[model samples]
Target: VAFAGVMFHLMIGSVYAWSVFTNPIAKQNGWAESSVALAFSIAIFFLGMSAAFMGKVVEKIGPRLTGTIASFLYGTGTIMTGWAIHQNSIWLLYLSYGVIGGLGLGAGYVTPVSTIIKWFPDKRGLATGLAIMGFGFAAMLTGPVAQQLMASVGLEQTFYLLGTFYFVIMLLAAQFIVRPNLALSSITENSISQKKGTRLTRGPELTANQALKTKSFTFLWIM
Candidate 1:
């Protein structure tokens, strides 16, 4: 599950490589730099906004389905961006790569982190760190790979190919990802004594409404 989560994140994190496409797109379309840049900004804004609500969706539907949907939306968005570019329609690019793709990015980003934490309760910090690290690492390779693809196949074709690649990889990875059964009897029994020296404490789990009523939540929001 952890490995699958990492693989999913690696593809979604290609969003970080948006900058690589900016110059090429702007040059090809005779677009002002700011206009071209707005696509990336819009995608990022939607990514954040969607994540806030998608967590509940994931909780309801499970990670596998959420991830599969994410792959579809994201992959389709990427392919649509190619069509948008070919047609010289910036608004379509925003609709495809910004709204649709951003929604997928949000869902894909959250599902794995949440699921992996459940699977590695004993080392949740480590699990989350490793999972998120895939996002950062994605930027490393995608920039160069996208650059090469753009040079070889042109920008539109690059989007088409990369979209297909992401769709397949994320779809396959999603099939192997499942939420851990945190309430399993064996898990509870084994975890009870695992961390002997640590000052472990348990408390009532808070619902969203209850959590919002707390000072900590208010302070964190302010911060």
Candidate 2:
């Protein structure tokens, strides 16, 4: 259930569902369909670009920071997209949903996979599979939700409602999705043991360059 929550939070925020908002935005603005499509393409570009860096950042700073930042970025992006409507500035839409929101998507995308794997080490595959499943279903949920909210509140207000909902849910998931402490302790213990064994048998200190030149090292590198 915990794993499911993580997946739902991350995947539900996916930009795939952004298509649902496109027709309405274009119809209201009297813009061409092609122009609306461009927004999605740009947003996808940002999603891919941000994903490359966000994964490493997650590893370095941890999931909480990554998730928190993602929520803020995504939430602000949604709000800004709505603001773009009020202002009729297409560029603002791209900047918010395409750049900032995509960065959030990338960060949220990776956090749960690694953290959940550690939590359920024996069922890593299942954990990963379930986590991504929510992402796929997010669009299904978003489409109807978008329609209902649009009818009741209109486009501008719909963005605000979705933005606020995603922010709160994602923040909660980030706060609760913690890395297992045992993993760190185990790695530390192993490193200490390696250092202790090396201390007594210090025959010769080979630099990294020197080690690289050795036949055994060369063989291992090939493998």
Candidate 3:
């Protein structure tokens, strides 16, 4: 599951390669670079906003469903990006890449992070770091490849090819991102219980109003 999550992250991380398309898109449309760059900004803005909601969505539907949906949205959005450019419509470009693609980015980005933590409850930090590591390293892998694709096939075609490729890879990766069953979970829980002492202590539960006054909440707010 962790490996699959990593592969999924690597495929979606292509968002960081947006700059590779900026100049080519700008030149093709005779638009100002700043104007074209706004698409990346919008994509990022929606990426953050959509992710906030999609995390909860993943919790309810599981990573496999969310990831599959992400593959479709991102892939279709990329193909739409090509059409947007071909039509020379900046508004359509923003809608395709910024809105649609950003939604996919949010779902794909959060799915692995949240799901991996569940899979490795005893080593949550390590699991999260391992899954997200691919995301962090994605640009280094995607940038040169995107540059070469543009050079060989021109601008729009690159989007088409990459969109198709990402769709397939992400779909396959999503298949392995399943939630572990109760039998396996119980075994891990038993190990953790043995290590932490047979009996576990529970912290006092707090409601929203009560939690607001806690030192931990204050520190979290400050952070």
Candidate 4:
């Protein structure tokens, strides 16, 4: 699950590579850089919005379905971005890359972390951090590749190729993220409770009088 989560993050983190397209899209379409940049902003906006609603959805449907849906939406959106650019339609770009792709991003972003959390209830923080590590490095991993693709094949083709590539990788990764059966619900719960109790209550207790008699308390009284 953690590995799947990493792969999911790696592909979706390509969102961070939006800057690679800004100038190329602007120049190719004869649009302002600001205009081209708006697609990225819109993508991010929908990403937040979709993520807000999709958390509950992930709880209900599970990550596999949600992750598959994300792959479809993102893959389609990326291809549409290429078509939109070829048509010189800014609105289409906004609709495809921004709204549709962002929705995919939201689903992909939540699926792995939530699923991993379920699998590793005790080490949720570590699971979440490990899952998301790919997102941080995605820009470094994908940025230069995108630049090279653009330089070689031109803008629209790059989007098409990348979209196809992302779709395959994300789809493959999504398969590995099966939610745990959870038939051992009671045991899992007990394990989590025991672990938490061990961590929080392991220290020796201090009586109230003994605490008050400490040197720190004396300094406070003087102040």
Query: What TM-scores do the predictions have?
Result: 0.92, 0.78, 0.91, 0.85
In model 3, residue pairs whose N, Cα or C atoms come closer than 3 Å (at least 3 residues apart or on different chains), thus clashing, are: none
By descending TM-score, how would the candidates be arranged? 1, 3, 4, 2
What candidate 2 gets wrong by more than 4 Å, as runs, is 1-14, 183-223
List the RMSD of every prediction in angstroms: 2.1, 7.6, 2.2, 9.1
lDDT of 2 by residue, 33-145 (tens): 77877877876677678776776787799878777887888788887888987778788877887777777777777777767776665467888778877877777778887
Model 4 per-residue lDDT at 42: 94
| For model 4, the run of ten residues with the poorest summed lDDT | 195-204
Expressed as tens digits, the lDDT of each residue in 14-101 for candidate 4 is 9998998899899989999999899999999999999978989998987899999999989889999999999999999999999999
Tell me the number of clashing residue pairs for each predicted model: 0, 1, 0, 0
Model 4, residue 184: C-alpha shift (Å): 3.9
User: Can you write out model 1's per-residue Cα lDDT over 110-201, one digit (the tens) per residue?
Assistant: 98988888777678899989989998899988999999999899999999999999999999999977886667635654665564754456
TM-score of 3: 0.91
C-alpha positional error of residue 167 in candidate 4 after TM-score superposition, expressed in Å: 0.8
Candidate with top lDDT is 4
Summing lDDT over every window of 10 consecutive residues in candidate 2, give the lowest-scoring window: 4-13
TM-score of 4: 0.85
Off by over 4 Å in 1: 182-189, 192-200, 213-215
Q: Regarding TM-score, does 1 or 2 come out ahead?
A: 1
